[model samples]
Target chain A: MTHLPYIAAAYALAVLVPAAYGLAAMRRLRLARTRLAALDPRPARRETRRETRR
Target chain B: MTAETSAAPGGFEMAPRAAMFRSVDALSSLATPAPPKAPGRSLHRFANPGRFLRLAGALQPWLTAGGLILTAAGLVWGLVVAPADWQQGDAVRIMYVHVPAAWLASAGYLGLAVCSVLSLVWRHPLADLAAAEIGPVGAAFTGICLATGSLWGKPMWGAWWVWDARLTSVLVLFFLYLGHIALIRAFDDPTRGYRAGAILALVGVVNLPIIKFSVDWWNTLHQPATISLTGAPSMYLGMLWPLALTALGYTLVFAALVTARTRAAVMERRIRALLMAAAAREDGAVQVAA
Candidate 1:
């Protein structure tokens, strides 16, 4: 535990940066999906049609 | 004379002349060949956004969960269970974070370069989106690498910063990522922005080899690569195991983030196109009213 402070700082950043980024990415995706569905629900309908065609 | 059968001043009947011209035009069109299809049509099959979105949606959850689980496990093992280095003591634990971030910094850029090629050469729609998404994430990881390296350096190298070849090259990479992120968003037209960013990414690729060989090519305060593809690792097995786990975890997390971001970008583009179409329809209606 000699360099405990340095270790903690490094690990905190390694975890926090990616965690924050990942959460933001997921949120953006959710918002995009919601907006897309509102603007045109055709994507969902298209998916259904695709499944049927398959 | 009936309007349909009226003769022109040139002594030809209007109806027959019109019919004759129509037939000649048809024959001329038939004689001309069709335009050639664009190259890389085959790649379009795999580059379909709808297909990619479905695959990414399915894979995102698994990648996120697995990445989080493995990263947590590896960090815990490295921090608590793994033995400390004989020389560096407990300070060596920083490797769990630092090394993985460094690896990701390099690997992520390579991914960006591949996306750039796909965008520039094949004109893959998803590639531009992927590159746009990858730039910010790669920059973040590169930032993490630099920060963690500084932390490790302060303890090991007796200074927080040094102008070593490896260090300076990585710093250049960080700026390259930043440049790409900015260039891709600079234009009002996203297509133009993507093209500019792709060209920059392709050009920046030369820095990769320089970053890789910098430690060997020049004398520096920074240490040479501890793990290499062609050679066995120089670290202890106890330390190596956790490092490996964390490296894999970081990679998975990187992939998940990029996929999710790219999915969002695709949705955003679709929304933009829909809005533009709606606006065009409104304009047409106004024109009709006018």
Candidate 2:
């Protein structure tokens, strides 16, 4: 634990940045899906069927 | 009917006119833009966004879950279970994060290069999106690598920053990532942006080998490779285990991130196309009314 702060900072960054980026991606996907569904529900329905079958 | 109104295919009389317009917009948008006729049939198979989206959707959850589990396990083992380095003491644990980030920085760029090839040579639709998505993620990993390396260097090397070959080359790599990210979004037309960025990515590939061999090529303060494909790792099994775990975790997570982002990019494009088609229909209706 001699360099605890450095260790902490590195780990925090390694985890947090990617996590944040992933969340943003997921959010964008969700928004896009919602818009796509509004425009036409067929693709979303197809996706749901595929998921259900899986 | 005007050209734009005619473009909206007939059907869906049961639905409202607005709904009919929306459906036509969506259908038109969903149609994949054909790539220039290319020789590689196998590569072209993945050019279809619908197929790629399906595959990505299936893989994303598994990748995310596995990555989180492995990364968490590796961090815990590195921090608590593994013995402290006798030379560097507790400071060596920084390698758990730093080394993986460093590896990802290089590996991610290699992926970008592949995307560049796919984009430039085959005109692969998915490749352009993948390249655009990969840049920012690659840049993030490189940034983490540099920050962690600096933290490690401050304590061990007595300098927070050094002009050593390995360090300098990696800094160059980081800047290359930044440059690619900026260049890809610099144009008014995205296709032009992708083309320019693809060229840059292809050019930047020269730095990868320099980065790989920098410590050996020059008398640098930075250490040489701890692990290589040709030889056994130069570390204890305890340390190696965590390193391996974290490295795989990082790789999986990187793939998942890129996949997710690309899917989002595809969706955004669809949304744009749909909006544009709808606008065209509206314009046509207005013209007809006038």
Candidate 3:
């Protein structure tokens, strides 16, 4: 049981660090998509412009 | 997207079905798998940034969770409940970390090499991205392998480090991994850097086989394989399984890390494209005024 601590440390480091990194990336992706959506304004404007010009 | 419009009396209009055909087709393609085009191996269309993003998004959490749980299980099983060795005692415990780290260092490089080969041969852009992204993760694991090896070494070998063949080869491997990591991001021209790093990855992979068999080939301080000659392993079942479990956990972690990093890379590419488009539009307006 005592040696268990050593094993636990290795496992924790291996698993937790990467998991936290991934979840953070996913959250960031959501935020980024939201920001981009805001920046795009309205799709109708661009679509109408392209349709009339073409 | 190209279609003919009907010349109606008062207005230029197409039939509703004809007008909506392109959008409908696009929607249908997104919704359906479109059948297995090839039975042996599917064409590599998903390598495109958009499809890659979708697939990677789905895979990210499952991989992260499986990695975390299995790693926790492996740790608990390996360190706590598993019996200690009669020969190496507590020192044998290091194998749980060392073996897996060592295995992954080799395995990760192999993955990198495969991507490199694909990049070189098929000229797939994402292959280079894939290869480059795994560099830091591999380097980190390789570093861990070295540190843990040294920690184990100090106690058992009567010194913190030694110039033994196996250790030295592994140390060299660590450097190669580090060098690859440094080379990829060091250049402004990302293509030049990715190609350079790919070459280095391929070159360095040769050392894997050398490192693996170095103990057998030369006089060395490192012990031979812990799992023995044949069926199962010579080691106790409890210890072996836990070692196995830890290895799996490490592997899972590696998979998750690469996916996250690669997804970030893809998003960054899209962000750059968006900015460039915005900048181009601004320039065009300025030119029109002039």
Candidate maximizing DockQ: 2
* Residue B180 C-alpha lDDT in model 2: 100
Q: Global CA lDDT of candidate 3, please?
A: 0.65
List the RMSD of every prediction in angstroms: 20.6, 14.4, 15.9
Q: Among these predicted structures, which one has the highest lDDT?
A: 2
- Whichever of 1 and 2 has more DockQ, that candidate is 2
* Per-model lDDT: 0.78, 0.79, 0.65
Q: Model 1: runs farther than 4 Å from truth?
A: A45-54, B1-40
Give the TM-score of each candidate.
0.85, 0.86, 0.78
Clashing pairs in 2: none
Q: How close to the true structure is residue B236 of candidate 3, measured as C-alpha lDDT?
A: 71
Tell me the spans in candidate 3 whose CA falls farther than 4 Å from its real position: A1-54, B1-35, B38-43, B228-231
lDDT score, candidate 2, position B49: 65
Please give the TM-score that candidate 1 achieves against the real structure. Answer: 0.85
